[model samples]
Target: MSKVVLITGGSSGIGKSVGEYLTEKGFVVYGTSRNPENYKEGKFPILELDVKNIETIKQTVKTILDSEGRLDVVVNNAGAGITGAIEEIPEAEIKANFDTNFFGPINVIKAVLPQMRKQHGGLIINITSIAGYMGLPYRGIYSASKGALELLTEAFRMELKDFNIKMTNIAPGDFATNIAAGRYHAPLLDNSPYKKPYGNTLNLMNTHVDNGSDPNMMAQAVLKVINTKNPKGHYKVGEFMQKFSIVLKRILPDRVYEKILMKHYKL
Candidate 1:
C-alpha cells in the first residue's frame, strides 16, 4: 500500500507545494488549512485543521487513521512569520506565534504517536526556519518559536527511538510565499526606539524571502527524506549563503558569527 501523509498549513506556500509533490509521487496525502473552503481546489484533500487547536488535530488524525488504516508521515509545516524588534512586539503576539509554531506541532506529535507506534514505524518532520539557528534583528520571536520547535524535535526523536518512530527538523531559509504578506508587524509608535531599524530590517527580510529558493525544492527535500529508512535529525533547505551560515556558526567564534549577522542586516 502507498504511504499516508498529513501536512499542516497546506492551503498555500511550502505546505501546499509539499502536499502536491507528495501526491504526485503516489503518496496518499492530506493537506490541512484553517478553513477548508478556501482551498477547495487544492490538488490533494484539504482537511480543516488549526494546529493551535488540540481537539481539531486529534479529530483530523483520527479521521485519517480510520480511513487509511495507517499514517506514515506527518509534516508539521503550518506557521506564520513575525517581523519586528523584540521589545516592539506585544506579549500576546509572541504567545500566539509560539502557540502556532511550537506548541501546535507538539500537540500534533502527541496525537499521532499512538498511531505511529502501533504501526511500528513513522516519520515526523517539523518545518523549522534557518533563523532558528541564529537570532536575527527584528525577527526574534519567530526565530525563537522555530528554535523551540527544533529542540522539541530532537527530544521527541530520542524518546521515540526504540518505538521505531523517526523525526526531523527541516530548517528552511526562505521561499517565495504568502508568508511575507502574512507576517505580523510589530506595533510601533512615532517615537519608538526601533523605528529606524524596524523598517530597514523588515524590508531586507522580505527582499531575502523574495530571492529565496522555490518551495518545490523544499518539497523535494522532504521527499528525499521520507524515502530514507533513517533520516538525519536536521535538514537545512535554502540558498548557498543561508545554508552556509549554519556551518559558519559552528566553525566561527561567537563574536565573529555575531558580526557576520550584524553586518548582513546592517545593524
Candidate 2:
C-alpha cells in the first residue's frame, strides 16, 4: 500500500509545491485548502479545511483516515504572516497570527495523534520560519507565532519519541512566493511609538520576502526529509536563512544576537 500524507494549506505556495512533489513520488497525498475550488486541477484529493477551526480539523483527519486506512505523514503547513511593529499592531491582530500559525498546527496534531499512534509511526513536518530562531523588526507577531511553533515541535519530538512518531521543523528563510505582497498588514496607530522607528524595518522585511528563494526548492527539501530513514529534529532551508542561522550561532552570543538584530533593523 502507498504511504498516506496529508498537508494543510495545500492550495498554494510551498504547501502546493510539496503536495505536487509527494504525489509524483508515489505517496497517496491528500491536501486541504480553505476553498477547495481554488486549487489547481490535479490527481490528488483536495479537501476543504480551515486550520483555525478545531472541529474542521478533526473532521478532515477523520475523512482522510477513512479513505487511506492509515495516516503516515501529516504536514502542518498552513500559516499566515502579519507585518508591523509590535506597538503598531492591535491586540486582535496578534491573536489572529497566533491562532492560524501556532494553534492551527496544534489542533491538527491533536486530531491526528490517535491515528498515528495507533499505527505506531508517522512523520509530522511543520513549516516554521527563520524568524522563529531570531526576532526581526516589523515581524514581532509573526515571529512570536513561529517561535511558539518551534517550541511545540521540539516538545512533541521528545514526547513522541517512544511512540515511534517523528516531528521535524523546517525553517525556511525566504521563498519566491506571493505571500510577501499578500501578507496581512495591520493598521498602524498614528500615536504609536514604533511608527517612526520601525518604519524602515517594515519596508525591508517586505522587500526581502518579495524576492526570496524558489518555492519549489523548499518543496524538494520537504520530500528529502520525509523520505530519509531518520529525519533530523530541525532543518533549515533557503540560502539566506541557512547562512543567517549559522552566523547567529557562531559569532554572536545570546545577548549579542539581539544587539545585532536591532542594529540590522536600525531599531
Candidate 3:
C-alpha cells in the first residue's frame, strides 16, 4: 500500500506543492485548510482544519486514520507570518503567531503520536523557516515561533526514536508563495519611532518572497528527505547564500554577523 501522508496548511502555497508532488510519487496525500470549501478543485482532498484549534486538529487526524487505517507521514506545514518591530508589534499578534506556528504544530504531533506509536513507525516533517535559525529585524516574531518548533523537533526526535518514529525539521528559505498576502503586517505608523526603518524592511521582505525560488524545490527536498533511511535532524532548502547565511552565523562573531545583516537590510 502507498504511504498515507498528511500536510497541514495544504490548501495552497508550499503545502499544496508538497501534497501534489507526493501524490504524483504514489503516496496517498491529504492536505488541510481552514476553509476546505474554497479549495474544492485542489488535486488532493483538503480537510477542514485550523492549526490553532485543537478539536479540528483531532478531527482531521481521526478522519484520515478512519479512511486510511494508517498515517505514515505528517508534514506540519501550517504556520502564520508576522512582521513588525519587536516593541511595536502588538503582544496579542505575537501570541497569535506562536499559537499557529509553535503550539499548533505541537498539538498536531500530540494528536498523531498515539497512532504512530501503535504502528511502530512514522515520520514527522516540520516545515520551519530559514529565518528560524537567526532573528531578522522586522520578522522577529515569525522567526521565534519557527525557531521554537525547530528546537521542539530536536527533543521530539530523541523521545520518539525507540518507537521508530522519525522527526525532523526542514527549514526553507523564501519561496515564491502567497505567504506574503496572508502575513500580518503592523500598519506603518506616521509618528511611531520605527516608521521609516520598519517600512523599508517590510518592503524588502515582501520583495524577497516575490522573487523567491519555485515552491516545487521545497517539495523535491521533502521527498528526498522522506526517502532517506536515516534522515538528519535538520535540513535547509533555499538559495546558496540563504543556506550559507546559517553557516556564517555559526562562524562569525556576534557583531560581525549583525553588521552583515544590517547592511543587507540597509538598516
Candidate 4:
C-alpha cells in the first residue's frame, strides 16, 4: 500500500520540490496551495487551500481522507517571512505571520490527529528555520513565529508518542526559496519607525536568501525523513554556511557570535 502524504504551500520553493520528489518516490501526494492549478505539471494532486483559514484546512483534510481513505504524512510547510523591528511592526502584521506560521499548522494538526490516532501511526514534518533557534535583529517577527513552531513540535511529539505518531521539525538554514521575495514588510511604509535602520539590513538579508542553497536539495532531505523508519526530532538542511552558522553559535562565545552577526549586517 502506497503511503499518502499531504504538503501545504506546495506551489513553489521547498514545498514544490518536496512534493515533486515524494511523488516520484511513489507516495500518493496531495499538495495544498492557494493556486493549485499553477503546479499542475508536477503530477501530484493539488488542493486549493490557505492554511490561515481553519475551515478551508478542515475541508481539504476531509476531502483527502474521504477520497484516499488514509494519510501517512502531513508536511506543514505553508509559511511566510516578515521583516522589521518588532516595535515598528503593526499588531496586524504580527498576527498575520503567526496565523500563517504557527496557528495555521496547529489547525491542520488538530484536524488530522483524530484520524492519525485511530491509524496508530503518522508523520508530521514541520518546515521551521534556524532563525527559530536564534534571534536576529530585523527578523524578530519571523523568528518568533518559527520559534513557536519549534516548541509546538516538541510538545506535540511528547504527547503523541503513545499513539505512534511522530513529529519532526526541519530547522533549515537559508534555502533558496521565494520566501524573501514574498516576505511581508510593514504596511505603513512611509511612516515606519524602523525605516532608516532596517532599509539596508532588509536588502542584505534578501541578498543572502537570493543566493542560498537549492530548494531541490532540501526537498531531497525531506524524502530522507519520510523514508527513515524512525525519523529524528529535528534536522538541519542547507549549505555549508548554514551548517557552519549552527555550529559556530553552539561553540562561539556570546560576544564573538554577536560580532559575526553585526559584521554580516554591516552594523
Winner of 3 and 4 under lDDT? 3
- Distance (Å) between predicted and true CA of 267, model 4? 1.1
User: What TM-score should be assigned to candidate 4?
Assistant: 0.94
lDDT by candidate, in order shown: 0.91, 0.84, 0.95, 0.87
Kindly list the per-residue Cα lDDT of model 2 for residues 46-131, writing each as its tens digit. 89889888888888888987877899998888999888867667788789889999989988999999888999999999999888
Q: lDDT by residue for model 1 over 176-227, one digit each (tens)?
A: 8889888888866689888877877778888888887899999999999999
After superposition on all C-alphas, the RMSD of every candidate to the true structure, in Å, is 0.9, 1.9, 0.6, 1.8
Clash number by candidate, in order: 0, 0, 0, 0
Order of models, best lDDT first = 3, 1, 4, 2
Q: How much is the lDDT of residue 18 in candidate 1?
A: 98
lDDT of 1: 0.91
C-alpha TM-score for every candidate: 0.98, 0.92, 0.99, 0.94
Best candidate according to lDDT: 3
lDDT of 3 by residue, 116-207 (tens): 99999999999999999999999999999999999999999999999999999999999999999999999899999999999999989999
> lDDT (0-100) at residue 225 of candidate 2?
90
TM-score of model 2 (CA atoms):
0.92
lDDT of 2 at 226: 86
Off by over 4 Å in 1: none
Candidate 1: pairs in clash: none
Displacement of the residue 213 alpha carbon in candidate 2, Å: 0.4
What lDDT score is found at residue 222 in candidate 1?
A: 97
